[model samples]
Target: MSGDVVVPAHNGVRRGRPPQTPEQADEVRARIELATAAVFTEHGSRGLSVARIIERAGISRPTFYRYFGNAEQPLHSLLTLSNEGLVGGIRDALARSFEPVQLGIAIIDAYLEWARGHGPMLRPVFAELHDPASPVSGYREEAFDDIRALVRAKFTELGRPLPSPLDLDTALQTCEYVVYRVSAAAHPGSEPDPADVTEARLTMIRSVLVTLGNRADVERALTVPGIFDERV
Candidate 1:
């Protein structure tokens, strides 16, 4: 009868009324995240409130507070989820390509596709991380580390050297900046039309290729019709 007192473990298992299976707990967590994203997309972080999130998520106040201490916690969760999705997509894309140039193009396309799909949810999270005064800024380093690891893994797999004139870390950091710019532009409020988004994605891909000393690959990638188009 005291569902309100249910406590969740690190793995998301909750000890409470009727006892939820791990899968159920995961579903609950995912539901909360999806609802958080939808609400955040509709109302910027500045306007976000616990009440609204709980309402949108269709969960009790106790449930919301049990999973997240505050609005920022869910935002952090969203950021983590976004990174997981991006990394997973990149891994899958890499698995499908044997050619180094094709792998590079796939990575770029994977990133842009993920951003385009999740930009609404990601914009405010990124905005907070970019703000020096925001407590969420601490997450910036974590994000950078995740991205760097992904880049390192890709280079290792391809057995290709990183571009000269810049160390791997520096090159990845620069690439992160390019991703940030593209993600910002793709944010729901500022998203360009489809044609413009395609152009921007291609531009980012070309820039990435050049930075990685793969300019020749860019021309090859462009020769494919709708090469930049989001894959189903």
Candidate 2:
């Protein structure tokens, strides 16, 4: 009977015995958040379900409501957090100037590191990349939009002829496809192998450079001694 009483939660009714202390409540809230992310990782946005989350979290419906209005809140929060982290480093790198090849390597570096760190969560998030309703779907475009604007500003500041805008956007998208492949990897022995990871990085760099009409420079950069060496 003690555990059956209805209690107020943050946004829903808590059906179980409530936390006796603020710390306990916070702890339960964190557990729910983790569970939400786990569910999101297992199922993309389209497959999200409150029932599954509650089952996964081992909490009653009311207890789940105590912290969230719905199942999507927790994962949305996670996506927001992940988006910041994944894009922040690239923003910083983009703020500074780099040679053409250097820029390619820089973006590749940022992307790979972010993927490795977020690998567990990456697969599901990227699966919905083109899903109009998915939060993750537009993130790549938004980041690319920012990059295009920034490159325009930077090039104008240098008094150089503007590269074709279409080319730039297509190039970025081309490279993004590679990242998506790595991130949304579902097959066994996909990205974990160091060789596959290395090859992906090399391809990303080369694709971007070639698309940008830097074919002459690509060979030189690609040949740079140790350019393909995996970063720790």
Candidate 3:
């Protein structure tokens, strides 16, 4: 039978054929994830439902179920996308730096840029992920592990020893938590003044750098043109 052949609805599956090609399947999944992000941004995860996703994506219930077993699936996809983008940004930034401090600045600058750009979608997604009861917490943990590995690699590349009291894993985790809390605070609909939020982010970056024994990097990062002045 052709891939487009419609299958009968049974066992709670939707009544439609799957996408005919891998590309089509990918497109459908992207559409659903985008719709899911939009819905989650406007209405927190608690408000997200399979019906709302179907309405937003113009897909049927079974189609959604075919692509995702539950409402969290799309959110998980969004989180995965976010994590990939972040890792990509960090890697790109690190490529442009030679010194450890420069690497630190690059990472912070890239993170702040991403946080400001995707704060809306990230806010709700992370809030849900941070919840112990969330079904997709594994995704969050995995993403963090990837980030931690990247950080450790950067430090190793610098050839600079980490502070005596700080292990690589703990320091990376601390930095990650700091970024998470800062991004959460800077999310849209929180602080009214963008300047204040921007300052708060700068402070967050500076504090994290200091915690990592990179105070000089904080100064260099803040001196970068448009790093602090731009409104998120």
Best-performing candidate as measured by lDDT: 2
> What is the lDDT ranking, best to worst?
2, 3, 1
* Alpha-carbon lDDT, every model: 0.68, 0.71, 0.70
Q: In candidate 1, where is summed lDDT lowest over 10 consecutive residues?
A: 163-172
Which tens-of-lDDT digit does each residue in 59-143 have in candidate 2? 8999889888987888777776766765776666666645666766776677677777765667776677788888777765676
> Candidates sorted by TM-score, descending order?
2, 3, 1
Q: How does each model score on TM-score?
A: 0.66, 0.73, 0.68
Comparing 1 with 2 on lDDT, the higher-scoring candidate is 2
Instruction: Kindly provide the TM-score of model 2 when superposed on the true structure, using C-alpha atoms.
Output: 0.73
Q: What 10-residue stretch in candidate 2 is worst by lDDT?
A: 183-192
Name every residue pair that clashes in candidate 3. 14-62
lDDT of 3 by residue, 62-87 (tens): 88998899987788777677778777
lDDT of 1 by residue, 1-232 (tens): 6457755776896546776789988888888887878877776666678888888889999888777888767867876667677677777887787775676577778876776676555566556656775544655566556656666666777787744435544544554566566566653566646765566666655556556646567667667676545667
Residue 214 in model 1: lDDT:
65
